[model samples]
Target: MGRQNRSRKRRDEMNKIKKARYDAKELIRLKKTLGLLDAEGNEIMKDIADVVDIKTAKEIKRDAKTREQQELIYEHQESLEKGQKVKVTNDKTGVEHVFNSKTLKDQYGNYPAWFKKKKTAKRLRKKQHSQTKNFKQAWTTVNVPL
Candidate 1:
């Protein structure tokens, strides 16, 4: 009886999570259809339909955090385009290091450290899985074929 109750509770929790996700997706869809939100989910500043309809939504205000991120991205892109060296501070070690623009990205194109690690692990796993079992003996026997 206790096991059954626990299972039922877990199922109910899962259903609630699914419903919340669905509701969020539906809200986004409705906002996009109404022109209240952009394709990237940014809100538009247009006046309400009842009030003086104005196209003030063109002026989107970005928070300071987003603005700083955009600046950083611009700097990185500019550095890459101009063949200039850039300085980067390591988050873990607090050490500043200079790197060439070409060295910033991996062979697979724009990928961060964590993503590179994940891809490396996945490749190794695939390689290990692809090896077949060997039936040959370590040492050659007299009857073994060449």
Candidate 2:
């Protein structure tokens, strides 16, 4: 009877492990669909989960906001460095604004003009500020002669 009980316990443990793996996979898929995973395959959901029990939901919300802001700042800085011209179309206004490297620098101090909108600009500023506080930050710095 003791051996049988031990075998059954092992089987139950295996099943629990399998279930956890399945749940992780499904959560990853859902996070990807929700745009919560970066290109490096880091899952924001996992980060949230790590802090969920210890931290308040409001803190998680703030972290998410900061993460998104940082991503936008990095993307804008990269586009500016690359001297890539971009066309932004406003769905509501149906107006397309073209921004080249020079125009971007002239308008937004090394950031793109499309990013100059009040909402985005505020986020980018916050992101840049946070990044400047941290050491070991690597950014793509490209110089193109126009």
Candidate 3:
């Protein structure tokens, strides 16, 4: 009886692992169909890839709201002058907040966080260089005899 119970528990654990793997495969398939996955099966856009069929409609709506807010903040900062007043609106809540550049800086320390740290092409080039160098070093070491 003890051995039978242990086998049943093991079977249940295996079934759970199998189900999780199957679900992951299905998610990958759906992501591919939606063009969220690249040809190499890696996620092209992680944000979109994460919003699979399992995500609730409310979650998608919230994500859209956040993106819209970010865009509004960007536009406001672009058009802002030192003394000019800007009206920022929340599309989701329909609330409008007005602030000049001075006021914004006093309150938030920065206008748009996105514009504060813009990633340059140089940064990407350096990142690529480091990645390739690491890969080459790894390959050479692995192929070398002890």
TM-score of each: 0.30, 0.26, 0.29
The list of candidate 3 runs beyond 4 A from truth reads 1-3, 46-146
Scanning candidate 2 in windows of ten residues, the lowest lDDT window is 137-146
What is the clash count of model 1? 0
Residue pairs whose backbone atoms clash in candidate 1? none
Tens digit per residue, CA lDDT, model 3, 1-146: 34678889999999999999999999999888888888998877567445655778999877776765555445445544366667777688795656665434323444543343345444333334334433332122223233
Candidate-wise lDDT, in order? 0.56, 0.60, 0.59
Give the winner by lDDT: 1 or 2.
Answer: 2
lDDT of 3: 0.59
- Total clashing pairs for each candidate: 0, 0, 0
lDDT of 2 by residue, 1-146 (tens): 34668889899999999999999989888777767887777866556555436768999877776776567567656644656677666588796656565346432334443455666665455445534544233332221111
lDDT of 2 at 81: 68
Sorted by TM-score, highest first, which candidate order results?
A: 1, 3, 2
lDDT of 2: 0.60
Off by over 4 Å in 1: 1-3, 47-146
> Highest lDDT: which candidate?
2
